[model samples]
Target: MKRIFDISMSLIALVVFCLPLLVVAVLVKLTSKGPALYWSDRIGKNNEIFRMPKFRTMRIDTPAVATHLLGDPDQFLTPIGHFLRKSSLDEIPQLWSILKGDMSIVGPRPALFNQDDLVKLRTEVGVHALTPGLTGWAQINGRDELPIPVKVDFDAYYLQNRSFLLDLKIILMTVYNVVRSKGVSH
Candidate 1:
């Protein structure tokens, strides 16, 4: 049922928001000097790895590893990157992943494949067994502000208590956060 919802929402969004996405792609390309889409490795369901795509907000030189793992991650983002990050618009392309069943609309946000501590902690807490998501409990709760352990706790909570109603609540909270321009750390 959740998969159905994710797919349907993704398709509707892709169709209804096509022009906006194209505009974003053009903006990203004009504002930066790279491909409009960025594809990177991320940990997925059953602890497998998959390529996750997003609109390129950061420069092509960003470390292949996790953003938080870098010494000064913010220095790598383009001018439009901040806006994309704040608006969460850069993540729109992950709808493709949902369509491919590599991700769901609401689940624990996927971690970069190279984030050793995060990966280890997720495994230790058993937060890594499920499919990843574009928006999630951790995203609405605090996004980059929360500690990884706290995020893991939230992921574990969601894992144990997931339901369609909870997902709806998270989606609502996400929209609220996006509207208020709150809780985004980067």
Candidate 2:
């Protein structure tokens, strides 16, 4: 049921956002030296690694580490990167990952492949069994503001309480949070 919903919603969203996606892609290319889409190695369900595509928000020369880990991450931003990150426009390409079955529309957000602490904590709490999401409880709750342990706790809560209704709630709240651009520190 969840997979079916993911596919259906992803397909619909792709159709609805196709033009914006193209515009963003073109804008990214115009402003950055690298490809518009950045294929990041992310941890997915059961601790497996998958390539997740995001609109490239950082420059090609940026170190391949979590933005929070970077010293003065702003230095790596392409001209429009801050806007893309804050507006969450950089996430639009992940719909393709949803279509490809690497991600869900709602679940715990995927961790960077090198985020060993996050992966280990999630695995120990059994949250790694669930597929990663484009948005989730942790996202709406605090997003980039939450500490790793708090984020993992929210992921574990979703692991225990996930349902169609809960997903719907999360999706709605995600839209609200995105519109407000809340909790995104970087």
Candidate 3:
């Protein structure tokens, strides 16, 4: 049921956001020297690695590390990168990942491939068994502000309490948070 819902919603969202996606792509290309999409290596379900596409918000030369880990991350932003990150527009391309089965609409956000501490903690707590998501409990709770262990705890909570209704609630809250531009730091 969850897989079916993910596919259906992802397809509808892709269709509905088609124009915005194109516009973002054009803007990204015009404002940056690299490809409009950045294919990041992310840790997915069961600790497997998968490529996740996001609208490129940083320059081509930016170090391949978590934005939070970057010293003065703003220095790497392309002209429109701040706007893209703040508006969460950079995430639109992940709909394709959801459609492709690498991500769900709601689950623990995927960690960067090099985030060994995060991966180990989540694995220890058995949170890695679930598919990664575009948005999740930790996302709505504190997003970039949450510490890694706390984020893993939230993921574990979701694993224990996951239900259709909980997923729906998470989705709705994600939209609200995105609209309000809450919890994002980069």
Candidate 4:
């Protein structure tokens, strides 16, 4: 049921946001030296690695580490990168991941491939068994503001309590959060 919902929603989203997606892609290309879409190695269901697509919000020269870890991360931002990240426009391409079944519309946020601490903690708590998401409980709760342990706890809670209604609630909250740019660190 969730998979079906994911596919249906993703397809609709791609169509609904088609023009904006194109505009973002163009802006990314015009402002940055790299490709508009960034393919990241992300940890998916069962701790497997899969490529996830995001609109490139950092420059080609940026280190391949989490943005939070980068010293003076803003220094690597392309002209429009700050706007993209703050507005969450950089996430639009992840609809592709949703369509490909590498992710769900609602689940734990995928960990970076090199995030060993996050992966290990999630695996120990069984959160790694679930498909990664474009948005999740942790996202709505604190997003980039949450510590890793707190994020894992939220993921585990979602794992235990997830349902059609909970997913719906999360989706709605995500919209509100994104619009308000709440709890986002960058």
Task: Pick the lDDT winner.
Answer: 2
Give Cα-based local distance difference scores for all models. 0.89, 0.95, 0.95, 0.94
Q: Write the residue-wise lDDT of candidate 1 on 1-186 in tens digits.
A: 988999999999899889989999999989989899999899998789999999997899787976666788789998899899888899999999999999999999998887777788888878888889888999899888889889998998998999999999999999899988788776
Question: Model 2 over residues 53-169: C-alpha lDDT tens digits?
Answer: 999999999999999999999999999999999999999999999999999999999999999999999999999999999999999999999999999999999999999999999
Tens digits of per-residue lDDT for model 3, 127-147: 999999999999999999999
Residue 18 accuracy (lDDT) in model 4: 100
Model 3 ranges off by over 4 Å: none
What's model 4's lDDT at 31? 83
Q: Over 4 Å off in model 2, which ranges?
A: none
Off by over 4 Å in 4: none
TM-score of each: 0.95, 0.99, 0.99, 0.99
lDDT agreement of model 4 with the native = 0.94
Q: Please write out the lDDT profile of model 4 over residues 7-57, one tens digit for every residue.
A: 999999999999999999999999879899999999999999999999998
> In model 2, what is the error at residue 102, expressed in angstroms?
0.6
* Local lDDT at 146 for model 1: 87
Model 4 TM: 0.99
Better of 1 and 3 by TM-score: 3
Worst 10 residues of 4 by lDDT: 177-186
Model 3, residue 97: distance off in Å is: 0.9
